[model samples]
Target: MSEPEAKRIKMADGTKAPVIGTHNGHFHADEALAVYLLRLLPQYANSSLIRTRDAEVLKTCDIVCDVGGVHDHDAKRYDHHQREFNAVFPGSATKLSSAGLVWMHYGKDIIASVTGLATSDANNDLLYNKLYADFIEAFDANDNGIPIYDPAALRSAGIEKRFSDKGFSMAGVVNRFNYAATEPRNAAKASVSADAPAAPKQKTQEEEDTRFQKASHFVGEQFVAELLDKAGSWLPAREVVKQAFADRAQYDAQGRIIVIPWKPEGVPWMEHLYNLEEENGAKGAVLYALFAESGEPDSKWRIRAVSLEPGSFENRKGLPEAWRGVRDEELSKVSGIPGAIFVHASGFIGGNASFDGALQMAKQSVDM
Candidate 1:
């Protein structure tokens, strides 16, 4: 929509729709995602958006973001560009961007709106933190220009990237919407001015605003997709992990092995496992987990090592070294267990054709 046309949009009841204000020139992923996130609320679902840097105009706006040089949560100002600003998400070192700022204040409400959970629910708080850490923080880190790793540390460790993946991130995708003059608007006129310098072409205010809308929707789609997956798939898996953890003694008398009776793809178990372990005062107690490889009856069962920490690559304990990379009848002969499939070369995981075989592998590995 044109800038003039969007100056004010009235609600259905003839009341003035609340206005969201931001900078006008070019937009970035932080502000784009910020605006989209705000619109997810009931009050702002039909709110009008005004992209401008004018302080007076922003003063009249119900909410201002990424342009107003203020970070007052009570006043609904969420800009992060002020020289003195150093606000980060609670308990996190990464600095806030407009996206993270918006999320910090209104994330629970947004989660409720999308997932129909009570705003005060414990699960809502879980998702609020989970979504930020897994998804929203990247936008904050990118907009603030924070590298994932300290460059000096990476260099000191002699870790060099084998190839470049420039312009391949979600931030890069959003940046593609920024206005660029692919070719001069009037090439012939510029050619005629051989001796004089030609002024660079620029997108009109309306064109720039439209691109901003496109960019917002682009990031917003991804944000919603991630939120839904967390709420729908990831949240439910917490219960399964909790149950399996509680039933650990059924598989191992010493409670060293937990069993997931059923197998579903992409089940997130480690974080919940660690939390449960700490809560029950059994931290670092679970060494192995056994579960069916698939829902199919004849499918193999897997015996896997538990990680030392949630999301860590290192494990607390690995399968026997003798079983590593051994497969089929040879694996069965080496372990003296029937229906053996193979063990991972790293010994983090192994598979067998039946639940009893997989269970025996875990029991033997624990002794080793």
Candidate 2:
């Protein structure tokens, strides 16, 4: 099918709004999130949302997602359940759900708008990729019924079991809204089945619409919360981390360690540092970072090893070998730093009772 021309709805105030349509009866996280993402754009900020499966009703909407039979991006029909449909995002093994499909096409613009970062900003791309890896990928994988681990491979490797189950994820929360007193909680389970027909409804159409609205509102709040953290908290820290990286030479003559101003909490420092090094063509030049704790005494500081990647335990440069598995006065004695508190046995990080002690620990690790 060819792409349809965009349609706009005129609000009561005479303002134009996009009309977004999805299936009715039951809602899931993928569709809820997809709708929320569309509204994040300025063009759709006050869009009218319609919940229905009526072919004629969906035809009147500007974009029909997760319900229409077609999966054409140009046509703005984003369903994935057709037997012949086997679409996946470029470079991704998992099939795309409505949420993933929307994100793949519009995530950069949505993230840029939410974070107040210009489309051309370097961090815009970084945040977009990070959000997908950490947040959106699980939605796509779960909707596609991809297993977290291959059970056969695990048994062959002598692994006894996977440690954790999928807990109360966002998808689970959305499904809960469909619950009604007449039906068992499991009734919502059908929402996850790509080809399962919608379960018979126990509630009136008015009641079902109310529940869908609640689910959409809940999902919208979640989207906003995550966006605020990424923008207000994380984006600001990138600047601090970048500056410390650029000034590493002043912190230590060898330019191996960076000392950032105190921060209230940890951010994506490792990722920012790694990206900065790549951009400057000085990969692996930074080894450690020292920063004071906000609202703590000036004597307290944290000395952290720069990880090779975010969420990785491996470090570009670990603490001195002698300091490993040492603590308190003993650590102080061996390290020749009086205020040394402890070094994690894993060598990822350590604590010191004074700024000078932490600085010495990071510098000595670099020298070692």
Model 2 CA deviation exceeding 4 Å by range: 1-10, 14-18, 83-91, 112-115, 158-167, 180-201, 252-254, 265-268, 278-285, 294-297, 307-309, 312-317, 324-332, 338-341, 344-347
RMSD of 1: 3.8
Model 1, stretches more than 4 Å misplaced? 1-7, 180-200, 263-266, 309-314
Q: What is the TM-score of each candidate against the true structure?
A: 0.89, 0.78
lDDT of 1 at 246: 85
For candidate 1, what is the total of clashing residue pairs?
0
- Residue-wise lDDT of candidate 2 within 179-200, one digit each (tens)? 8443554665555555665756
Q: Write the per-residue lDDT of candidate 1 for residues 325-350, one digit (tens) a residue.
A: 99999999999999999999998899
Q: Give the distance in Å from residue 337's predicted Cα in candidate 1 to where it truly belongs.
A: 2.2
Please give the range of 10 consecutive residues that has the lowest summed lDDT in model 1.
1-10
Model 1 TM-score on a 0 to 1 scale = 0.89
